[model samples]
Target: MKTPNPARRSERSRRAILSAAFDLVAEAGYAKLTVEAIAARAGVGKQTIYRWWPSKGAVFVDAVLSLSEDDTGGLSLPDTGDLRADLSGVLRAIVDEYNDPRLDAMSRALTAESLADPTLNSEITARILGPLLEVTKDRLRSAQRAGQVAADADLSVAVELLYGPIYHRWMLRTHPLTHEYADTVVEFALRALEPAH
Candidate 1:
């Protein structure tokens, strides 16, 4: 019998691990998640998991990212050439995710875990939020080219303006996160980024 190659892991197994990690968090919350459980659920050895990920947080973050990224492992936002509509659509989807019971619990748990682990926080930012922000900035750059945004506008700041309010509302739970609320945030952000008249 030939030993399986350690350098080239089966993609199916990798996906199974990610799916198991996600389902475990959704079912039992992140506090109860463990690499052993993920390995068992994935039908792989704990050593396999350890070799692939440094921590359960890393596995879980990758799981979350797997859901958002495309087959090519890239993320993007819609660009209808209408900045307002595109941004509104994106914000509304974010509100919907925050409102989901399973995703809400998972997201909150990840946030709590990140607070205590700076490394995990950085990973979340770099792996998850960073790509999302960059893609959003790309969309904003397109809007700028279309004369929908100020040419001199700082796009990084523009992306934050688009996303920050919804993030604040979700974190604080001060108001119901709804599509209408998303549209309102988009409106305010667009006003702030309006091309210099």
Candidate 2:
């Protein structure tokens, strides 16, 4: 049999480790997740994991990135030409995903990891959150160019206004993030951005 390239084997091992880490964290919570356990679950040696990821937190961040595949695809907000519909649709999807038990747990894990390690937090932001936010900002800028949004509106601030409340509610567990709630958010944001009478 032809020998598999070492790089290919290494890539496979890394993917397995990340997948195992995500499943373990999702099922057992981050507090209980460890590199040894992840290595065992992935059927790879501990040294393999250590060689690829520096720490459990690094593994967890990789896991989060792996699990975010679906949410991260498309990455850009929909520009349906109707700003209201586009923003509402995107926000609704985000709210739904935010409320998912698995995603919620993963998010909580990331937050905890961030609190414990500033480096991990920066890594996560640069790799995951930052890309997502950049895509959102691009969509908002598109809306502005199309005259769907006001010219003077700050796209970054506007995107934050649309998403900040949803994150606040999700993190605080203050209110249910239902479709109705999403609709209300879109309505309020549109009203605030509408041209002055």
The top-ranked prediction according to TM-score is 1
Candidate 1, residues 1-197, lDDT tens digits: the string is 98888546678789999999999988987878999999999999999899889999899888987885452124347898888888887787788889988888888988987898898799889888887788788899898888888999999888888788889989999989999999988989989999877
**Candidate 2 local accuracy as lDDT?**
0.79
Clash-forming residue pairs, model 1: none
Residue range 1-197, candidate 2, lDDT tens digits: 89869989888888889889988988887778888899899999999888877888777777776754544533346667788787788788878778778887778876886888788788877877777788777777776677666778876787778888988898899988998898888888877766545
User: Candidate 2 — which pairs collide?
Assistant: none
Model 2 worst lDDT window (10 residues): 67-76
Deviation of model 1 at 72, angstroms: 11
How many clashes in each candidate? 0, 0
lDDT against true structure, model 1: 0.85
What are the C-alpha RMSDs, in order, of all predicted structures? 3.1, 2.6
